[model samples]
Target: MLIDIFHDTVCPWCRIGKKHLFDALAQRQEQEVHIRWHPFLLDNTVPAEGYEFRSFMQNRKGIKAEEIQQIFDNAQRAGEAAGVKLDFDKIRLAVNTKLSHQLIALAPANVKNDVVEAIYQAYFEDGLNIGNFDVIVAIGTAYQMDASELKSQLNDRAVSDAVIAESTFARLNGINSVPFFVINDKVKVNGSHSVEVFLETLNRAALLDIPAKI
Candidate 1:
């Protein structure tokens, strides 16, 4: 079965959802599953240099700083429940994710999942500025992506455009949120559902794939 995951690098829920999906996959060891990652920018208008994280969240949600902290606390709890750590306090910037998305797009298929996981860890755990070219280049190189080639492509305007275009296409297709999943083009799971939910969806998709008697 093939699963297409649409997510943003900065989204904590996306990381949680990814863990749930993988946990589900782990339970179904008999099934052969393929994962394809897609980019979904939560806020494309964020400047290349990014914005102060707390202020941006407050302004974007029209909430006070305390309210923003409450929201972060909620997310942190959810992340911990899923066994994924999210240190929102350490995050300083709300960055444009186009470069990070491009790095994932260019990664080899076998290691693309690792690249995505690393990017999420970098931003959410370490609070590294994933919008920075240097950070993304380091991630790509660590994943065995050619260093010079990764740098060249990430710098290319066309590659960046392609990443944005993918996000646009997703929105045009009515995917306005991050952490959405399409399972075998048949089952659709939205938001950060539980491992049981994802495993159930996988089983449903597998059943659908079975041939009918004549």
Candidate 2:
């Protein structure tokens, strides 16, 4: 089964949703699946220096820090339950994820998951700046990827263009917010719902042969 996820780098809820999804997957041993990480920019045209991640959310999203904290609390709980660590205190920048998305899309099928997990953990837990080329190249290298090749590839127009195309495609699919999960290309779930909900929906989709949800 293929679960197509449209997500972003700076989204706390998206991080939590990913944790929930992975936890659901880990509990089951028999189901085989492929993870495809697609790009969805929270802000596509932000300035090069980017903006303070938390302040940007307060100003643009109009969500108070306290409300955001409550949300983060949920994420923290969800992440801990799932064995995922989220560095809420350390996250600071809202970077352009164009190149990160590009790296993910162009990566070989075998390494795409590594790319996705790297970005997610790096940005959300390790507090690395993924928008910068150097950090991305470094992450790509950690996966045993060629750093120079990745740097050259980032400058290529096709990958950035592809990121834009996928973002547009996501909007056209009626997806406004993310961690948007498209299961078997037929079932779609938005936001971080309970594991039971995911288990039920995924099993009913007939995408996995496993008789029960773990």
Candidate 3:
């Protein structure tokens, strides 16, 4: 099975969804599954340097403090239920995830999952600015990717453009939200579905004779 996950590193629900997907896969360990991470920027206009998390949500989304608090509360509950911890209070900045996505794209298949998980941990747990080059380099190196090569590729225009192009392709394909999952390119599961729901989708997709492409 080929699971094409379209998500941004900064999305809390994306982190939860990833956990659910992994859990579902774990249950079906006998089946072969390949995951391909794709880019989907939640706010493409966010500056590379990023903005204070509170100010960015309030100013850009025009969300009131009460509503934002409610959102955080709900996310916390959801994350807990999914065996993931989302420390919104620790997040200082809301950053552009273009560079983070580029790193994921550059990661080798064996370490790609680790790269993605590390990015999620850095942004949502550690509250690190994933948009920062040094922060991303640190995460890449920790995942065993060549730090110097990762840094060089991150600075290259072609790599950045490719990440942008992937985001554009996602938007063109009608993916308007994060945590979107495409199974074998034939079934689409949107949102942060539960583990059972994800498992059901995977089972259904497995029944099909579609060629898996990752």
Which number leads on TM-score?
3
Number of colliding residue pairs in model 1: 0
Clashes of 2: 0
**Model 2 agreement with the true structure over 105-205: per-residue lDDT tens digits:** 77778888767888888888888788887888888888888877878888899878989998988898788998799877778899977777777877776
Q: What ordering of candidates by lDDT runs from best to worst?
A: 3, 1, 2
In candidate 3, stretches whose alpha carbon ends up further than 4 angstroms from where it belongs are none
TM-score for predicted model 3 compared with the true structure: 0.97
Higher-ranked by lDDT: 1 or 3 = 3
Q: Which ten residues in a row have the lowest lDDT in candidate 3?
A: 54-63
Which tens-of-lDDT digit does each residue in 39-117 have in candidate 3?
9988878897899998778876788988888988999999999999899999999999999999999989999998999
Give Cα distance to truth, residue 75, candidate 1, Å. Answer: 0.7
User: How does each model score on TM-score?
Assistant: 0.96, 0.88, 0.97
Query: Residue 129: error of model 2 in Å?
Result: 1.3
Give candidate 2's whole-model lDDT: 0.79
Better of 1 and 2 by TM-score: 1
Top candidate by lDDT: 3
